[model samples]
Target: MNEGDERALKVAVLGCGAVGSQVVRLLTEQRDDLAARVGAPVELVGVAVRRLDAPREVDVPAGLLTTDATELVSRGDVDVVVEVIGGIEPARSLILAALDNGASVVTANKALLAEDGPTLFEAAAKAERDLYYEAAVAGAIPILRPLRESLAGDRVTRVLGIVNGTTNFILDRMDTSGAGFSEALEEAQELGYAEADPTADVEGFDAAAKAAILASLAFHSRVTASDVHREGISEVTAADVASARDMGSVVKLLAICELRPGPDGQDQVAARVHPAMIPRSHPLASVHEAYNAVFVESEAAGQLMFYGPGAGGAPTASAVLGDLVTVARNRLDGTRGAGESAYADRAVQPMGETRTRYHVAIDVDDRAGVLAAVANAFADHDVSIQTVRQEGRGADAQLVVVSHSAPDSALSATVEQLREMDIVREVTSVMRVEGDAE
Candidate 1:
């Protein structure tokens, strides 16, 4: 090969699964356009998968497929490695090796990134290679790059999102049709929204992972999956949805990340994922069924939202290809992209220290004074009521109380006080209320 041909960038793909197949297809289909845009032709050196015999959607030469991911990434010819494998062990190890071998990396593994991103980012920084994962959080939404590049100069205060499609689909079905949780989940599974196992999506684990990544990027601090307070959609019953409708709201699985003040006057960040009651007027409430939306609040840019399909083979592949093009351009220019930020280095606050509003639904004896007793609990905890609705009097009365802005500690204490009252039969639901307009 001539010097010009030999210097062309070589790319290796790790994992040829659904998303990976689409990446390969796009690379081949859009080769001409991509070459023209990047100023140099990009070539696919090899693809690594667990089984070479497994059928693939993309047509590649047989010799280029390999079972050894380590060898493919460490190969001298590969200049960029795109990892689409969704796991922790070999993916992490292979990414580190690729960076060490003087190659940049782009991945779509949110689980691995949310768990051990800082470690891998540190390694990439040490090696001075670009590490991009635009596909990890909200697939095809272009959220990460906007926050990292476009809004880098602005001060971001909060990022609230409906990041998971499966949970959102199920919740939307329940709200619109009054379907039970199990029925909605079954329908989602039938339509491929919910996985067969469905633990990660329904239990809020997936949203929590995305929340940690967003909080870390928005606040310029380090936050992990363990730091997020998670509440899944499994416990969100039909009754809860009904209560939300009565109160002019809808239930959504929200991943909320905010930067607030700590006790010592320093910035404290809180990242949590839970099923919350969003007002009907909120923009996110209008987002329905398998669609994702992220609302960002910044000092300079003001309020901005990015909305689109959060997951799927084609959507995720679009993000990966975009990153691949950017990485290739950076490589041709002999430059590295921005690494992870530890700018503010703010501490992550405990859940109890975060302040918000709550909606508490209680089943009490059909008596006049029961409402007074519930109001007293709020007053005792120093949580003022924003709205109160009581209905179905006689034997089984239900009272719904929505609180004004209150400390997380006070909300918890108020719940405890209501639970201990003699007139209160049971606390049907206690959900956090968010996205109140400033």
Candidate 2:
């Protein structure tokens, strides 16, 4: 240490798992480079863990590992805390303590943020400290920073993305190899693309959390995970993939957030995560395997895409390190960086009220009046048909109807009415369509 230089910024790590291990490694390996970038030396003081003897992907120095995370955050001397311990409870409590104790925080906890971000943001603002989570949404793709900083001045209309790598990997396999959902999921698990319990990713909870964060950032509103309408890829069958193929598109689980006009002539926000069919030519359609991509639309920037590896140890760790540098630099400068922006406070419109398009496949009797009854049902519900194609043998025919954009309530009602009618045999599949003209 030089006598003439200011004291180095002390930082701490919470959790030494996959991403955390990589973070520790980078802090040790790239100490000088990070110090140069932040205009001050960034030192790792401690790593909080559940068990000291638990096997780790990377080795932790003997003196740094501790089981009590609460003590580390409230130590009064730490300048920044990097949290990779996901979930609520300890993570949230520790973060609040760190901020209240005058320490900046950089985390990758999407669940805590999506469920309760305003509280944390308010706490950080009260303490005049920065809380940055660049790794929360899309791994190393740099989506949140661009949305929060670069497009801060501009109005963002929409954000459509493939945010979950596990779902994307499963869907990509189903689309390419014509595999069933079970078959594709097994392959994903064997290839380490999915966890032993992949419920969060497959059931759309993970993406829904990310979508909530994206919506909150893009629209400047407070959107929670409950506000998002979620649908898993578990129900996405092989027939759905074939149906998408017939339309020159591919099936993908999408996290979509849009700034839409409300009935009162005010702009409202709608966020959702579901399996959708997007055109093959779309930028996100090409994001195959365990990769992530976000497509942003703004008034000034027009269109922009951020793509990269969405998860795993190294890619996610790199994002955590980037945030650590930014926060550390802000600490040295005696200035605070930007926090959450919920000034607009726009309404998060319900899924039933949101306007969307759908591709409906129906199996009906080949007899006369079947097509007429279906068309009349849609007309009764005020849903206009964009295209209609039918194929099958006598007494076992099918009709594929793609409808123009309409309120979800009306379209759903139309499908329900069709289900009750004698002429309609069964509603085989009803999937949303995105990345196309409405």
Candidate 3:
């Protein structure tokens, strides 16, 4: 090893929870290998935790554990700071301080990045330091780097996939076991796949944050969590899942980011997170249980799929270590990797104006002209139906209609009109259809 490689590079860790514990374990077990890869001995200088007396998963040296996170990052000798403390306030402040103190950062805080990434990027740029967060979006999956580097030259038209494992597990249970939303959620919680509150994952907030990060990277725009249109799987019923199965499809919570034309004919981005029906043949439909998958479509690379364990202590730590090694290498070389690239600065398209397809199921009177009246409702909104199926149960009937690609506003208007019709008893289900040609 060269003289510079002989010197140790110091690392500070914030938060000693699930991901942080696994990260510390990896750093200790693979210290020699990491040193050979980065051309410098990677050192764990300190670990900042909430309490020094708290029980930990890994055997952290008592001397290295400190509660003063602010002071740990502020230390001038620290060369890199690993932050797994999620949320907005302290994580954000510490990251900024680390960059300003001339230390590169590796983080797994998706909410922080999606909420206010520009602030961190600007700090890194001003300090000439690297801010790498590969563990943010999809746990161990190597999706972000590909979007930022491998596919940099190609024009990405769409990125649609499942980003949250908790939500996916619940939805998959509902499909495979024919259980309702509550039953599936109960199972997920029992298996430790979901939290007691599960609000962030079940209600789509987790996926929405990931979607914002994906849109910003794929489109080179500054997309935030507030910009994503989010809907959860809480309202998904067994009837909806059966409806999808009837059409040879399955329901999955999806984060979709696409480049569409704006009112001015310029390309704009639309990012949304919701439960959608995809054909059984689609690669994403096979992602079961707690696994996650992403499908990317570009001008040159027709279709690419990334699948793996989306969340876990060890899986997430793997991504964190990957970024740590890269940043360490850059530090030894006296250089920095690429920073945020928002040069495109494109506008975000409104959800109402976005074009998509819908699957609607209605309970109507089994009488003449009922189908005609329902067809007229769609016509009033200028929405055309692609396929229609009818089933009779003597006094009443059920109608299933799938519409072609149309403005979301128009599809919603048609559903509202059908609900008010005298012959229509109820609109049983309404869901968007994806993974098919428009």
The candidate maximizing lDDT is 3
Could you tell me which residue pairs clash in candidate 1?
Answer: none
Compare candidates 1 and 2 on lDDT and give the better one: 2
lDDT per residue as tens, model 2, 1-438: 222256889999999999999999999999999888888777999999999999999888889999989999999999999999999988999999999998999999999999999999999999999999999998988999999999999999999999999999999999999999999999999999999999999999999999999999999999999999999999999999999999999999999999988989899999999999999999999999989999999999999999999999999999999898888877877878898899999998889999999999999988878888899999999999999999886776899999999999999999899899897889999999887889
Off by over 4 Å in 2: 1-4
Give lDDT per model, in order. 0.91, 0.93, 0.95
Worst 10 residues of 3 by lDDT: 1-10
Superposed by TM-score, candidate 2 places the C-alpha of residue 80 at a distance from the truth, in angstroms, of: 0.5
Per-residue lDDT of candidate 3, residues 257-346 (tens digit):
999999999999999999999999999999999999999999999899999999999999999999999998888888889899999999
TM-score of each: 0.97, 0.98, 0.98
Clashing pairs in 2: none
The order by descending lDDT is 3, 2, 1
In every candidate, how many clashes are there?
Answer: 0, 0, 0
